[model samples]
Target: MKQNYIYIILFISFIFVTLYIYSSEIKEPLEDYDETKNPKLVFNGHWSGLFCNINRLVNFLVLYPNTREIDFNVLASKTHHKPFIGENIEIFSKLFQKYKEDIPIDTTYNYDGLDFTKFDLTHRKAYEYYNENRYKLEPYNKAFNKYLHLLPHLQERLDKMVNEMRSDCQQVIGVFVRSNALADEQPTGIMPTREEYLEAISKLDTFSKKTKYFLRIDNEEDYEFYKSKLSPIYETNIKRAKSNKGDAPHASGEYLSLEDLENTYLEIALLSHCDILVHCVSNMASAALYMNMNLVSICVSKPAAQ
Candidate 1:
């Protein structure tokens, strides 16, 4: 019996040693976004913030082939599936949790279509080509929008919540006002103002006694400011995102934890259901545009004034 036990222990040790050797042999070439050269074309970027980063991902994927890995470590803090603002971490898996195909790519092979392995973010010439010439959506890429879909569990929860919010049966409109924590962050020479919002609201001929609105603004004060200014006949719903110091609204505060990120996305998803979108130049609005391409945008700012 003693001899048999010794032999079994030796066999297990051999197996583990072999596995470790194989793992170490595997090369993670472009581990971070800055390196940029990968055997497979890695779609990655810095964390400009949630919706903005997602827009970059979606827009790039829309024009590219489907068989690439989302290099989640770009601005991510850790390689694991958590939201680390100081670092990107692998939040992609957590954010788009339900996607099951063409993801978690193998290191063995590349996509069958156009090979952009040599290209990186510093080169954006391809975007100019596709944007001007062949901007039309191909059937295969139409599902690219699904890339950012919420996990099944969150979807079910939000669906019920959104349904209840809209149960009053009204003409619902979503308004996204873009602002951030720093006063200097507002776009120079073209910041959106109360006057612009009022002018946009006045043109919403669809507003009636039954009309309801969802204001997905940057700050709680802005939320109430817009809410009070809009016609009294309409109702307003605002998602109270957890305060991040002054980075309220849809921003990740000092830290980007999983819960804060999830709520920000939830606000975007729920806003997609609105009958119309009155917005500033916001990536959150771009997210709603993902769901309804034809939705009318009431641009709160007038370029003529600028």
Candidate 2:
């Protein structure tokens, strides 16, 4: 009876050790296998602006290399006010050519069992991810160049605008001013004052009578102000906020038609063609940088603003 009792205890101990090893080692590998084999990221359209959304998409592709596919259907459903169906498809078709048929705006499909990582578009979180993987981000510029391509018609329009500017000016300096209610939307003193922008532009090597300024300001007041200060300013006929009191025309309750969004993108693309860009830290600036990696940028905003 004593020997039998000892044998029973040993058997129980063996079983417990086996279970512990399986839980600690075998189970984790199985989960990792699932993640690596079919990793999917979902975008829920958390951001408002067009470039903000584009930046989020670019961040995901750069940060997560194992991402086999992404679901923009959720983004499409959430962004009814700013419809991203056609433009979003056009953008992603270049990135994921193999999965073209899989990319559609379907909100009803069940994604229950498939484990997915949701992309959060907040600036702080994005920066944190960028810092954590800074060493591996050498491909960031390459990724942007590979993925972000303007539509053919838009590209043609941008070329024509550049040619027109070149005809009149020895150097085309792009100036992006985030004036008006963006200050209210962002932190205090984040937006550079009029004096600061003027000072930055004045310091540029190409600042001369022969240099033309390409303005991308949010409100008409700044538009007129810069046009007065920097003569021969060229701007597209896109909508601008009438006053400094309200949100930007696009961000305000005003309906942003497809043309408005395309014009916004066109402005950014045009900025890429400039000899130098003087701006603050905004999505527009970042998008322009992505479009032209070698474009010289002079940020007049405070360093903390970034």
TM-score winner among the candidates? 2
Local distance difference test scores for all models:
0.53, 0.59
Candidate 1 per-residue lDDT, tens place, 185-267, comes to 32343556778776777777653547777777766667677777654323334445343235443333345566656667778
Number of backbone collisions per candidate: 8, 0
Candidate 1 residue spans exceeding 4 A from truth: 1-41, 68-71, 74-88, 98-143, 180-188, 206-209, 231-253, 304-306
lDDT (tens digit, per residue) of candidate 2 on 146-227 = 5445667766777898888777778888888875445433234356889999998888776445888889888888888888
The stretch of ten residues in a row with the least summed lDDT in candidate 2 is 107-116
Model 1 lDDT-worst window of ten? 122-131
List runs of model 2 lying over 4 Å from the truth.
1-43, 65-138, 184-189, 207-209
Per-residue error at 163 for model 1, in Å?
A: 0.7
TM-score of each: 0.62, 0.66
